[model samples]
Structures are given as C-alpha cells and as structure tokens.
Target: QQQVKQSPQSLIVQKGGISIINCAYENTAFDYFPWYQQFPGKGPALLIAIRPDVSEKKEGRFTISFNKSAKQFSLHIMDSQPGDSATYFCAAITSGGSYIPTFGRGTSLIVHP
Candidate 1:
C-alpha cells in the first residue's frame, strides 16, 4: 500500500513569513504528488503538484519540491497570511491507477497577525 507521512501535525507562522512542511512516502509505484489546502468546513483544494519525472513545480506562492530517489516531498508557502492559514495535506497515487490518494494525517497552519 502507498503511504505518505507528514510531520509537525501543526504549525504557526507570521503574516509575512514562509511556511514549510515535509512528507515521506514508501511506495515506489506512486507517481503523483499533490498538496491540498483546506479551510474550516470546506473540502480540500489542490494547491500544487509534481510528478516523478520533474524536480519541482510552482504556482504563484505555492510550490512543490519533489525528490524521486529519496521518496520525499515538501511544500513551501511564501508570504503567508492569516487567510492562508488552514489544514494542509500531502497525498500520493499512481498516475493511471485509482484516483483515490493516500493522504498524510494533516497539518494545521495558523498564521497570526
């Protein structure tokens, strides 16, 4: 089974600082890396993603850095704000396999003003 594990179950950041989170996986068959952000009472939204064929992918303030050999990945948030505070989850799944993903426990980010 594909398993992704996340750390620091929670985090706190200043309104203008950067927030970083890490994740590790154990399945070599997994080929997709996606990060999701979720607000209270809402569903998670795809923040960014990277494939094993690529080293990294960035979308605005959100970036996903992938490591194929190490079987690890990380998410970086720049210029974080109160509005950016929410739960972040890292997930993995095979590209052509079932779309359902194996997710990390979750990290609650709280940006204080």
Candidate 2:
C-alpha cells in the first residue's frame, strides 16, 4: 500500500476541451489526495486535492474526483489551452503517519492550437 500509478504518456486536447487522466493507488491508509502540475523542468505544483472523506473536489479550472472504495482518483482539466500544456501527476499522502508522497509517473498533456 504505497504506490500511485498513472498512465497516458501523452494527451492531446483541443482548446476548450476537457482533459481527463486516471490514477490508482495501493495504500488504503492514504488520507490526503493531491494532483500536481509541472511545466518543463519545474517542480510540480499542487493543483487540486481531495480527502478520502470526500467524493469529489473542484477547483477553478481543475477538478479532483476520488473513489474511496476503489482506491483511485482522477484529475479533470477544463478549458484546455496551449498554455495548459504540461505534465500532471497524482499523489497521495498520510497526515497522521507520513507526509511523504507517492507520485504517479506523470501524464503529459498537450493542448493543441
């Protein structure tokens, strides 16, 4: 129970399209669910997150839908754009136990012109 796996080596979304990526985690003890967005060589930034207690959470242009029973989570990007082209990663953390995160390989999203 210590890994988060994501797929889709690359994604192509038209402008204003909705981009979706899925992730599965093994650790049932994970309480904090966070999705990070990284551009090129930069560090990943926390884009959105949800706790196991919640079914789903939404941010401005991003959304995180969590499945407690399935131990899975996904990130949705709305209004895709060329500017939004970046790598996305889904991660999980434990507050009471450890803050260290298990990150998914990453999903590279490309919003076409």
Candidate 3:
C-alpha cells in the first residue's frame, strides 16, 4: 500500500486568509518530509520541509509542522494571496537510501481576491 495520504484534495481561501494542507504517512522508514508547490505549466518546486528530528519549520509565510509519533505533517500558508494559488504536494523519502520520494495526491489551492 502507498505510505502517504493527503486530505482536503482541494481548497479555496479568500485573499489574506490562511491555507492549510495535511498529510500522513504509514512508513517508519520515511525520515525526510517535503512539500512541493507547482504553478500551471511548470514543474513542482520545493516549498518547505522538515526532518523527523524537528517539530516545526518555518520560512517566510510558509510553515511545516511535523509529528514524528503520529507520522503526520501539515503545511500552513499565512496571508495567502492569489499568486500563492497553486497545487501542493507532500512527499516522504527515506534517508540514506534510494532518495525517491513517495508523493501525496496533491492539494489544489485557490486564493480569491
């Protein structure tokens, strides 16, 4: 079975509001968790990431919270803007192994002005 699952397949947020996406993984082997953001007609880019050792990581308006015991993680976008609208994916990879990442289904976010 796939190790990762994501929820709220799609989301809509008013401008200046916050957007949240959640993901959970079943494999204990996964040590690296990353979130990717993609715009139309472009490849996905790394947004934020957290290691099993860290409880949370934040940069700019993006934040990632990780729960090692629960094997779950979440992404929060603060002050979302229309330009921030994009498809987001949460992925897990095993450290010191084949670095191939298992990606979640993806969350489509729309920020309306």
When summed lDDT is taken over every stretch of 10 residues in candidate 1, the lowest stretch is 1-10
Q: Which of candidates 1 and 3 reaches a greater TM-score?
A: 3
* Better-scoring candidate (TM-score), 1 or 2: 1
Candidate 2 lDDT tens digits, 29-61: 899988889999899898888998888898888
Q: Which residue runs of candidate 3 sit more than 4 Å off their true CA positions? A: none
Selected candidate, larger lDDT, 1 vs 3:
3
Q: Per-residue CA lDDT of candidate 3, range 27-75, in tens? A: 8999999999999999999998899898999999999999989889999
Task: Enumerate residue pairs that collide in model 3.
Answer: none
- Cα-based TM-score, every candidate: 0.94, 0.93, 0.97
Rank by lDDT, highest first. Answer: 3, 1, 2
C-alpha lDDT values of all predictions: 0.91, 0.89, 0.95
Q: Tell me how far the alpha carbon of residue 42 in candidate 3 is from the true structure, in angstroms, after superposition.
A: 0.3
Candidate 2's C-alpha runs over 4 A off are none
Q: Which stretches of candidate 1 lie over 4 Å from their true place?
A: none
Best by lDDT: 3
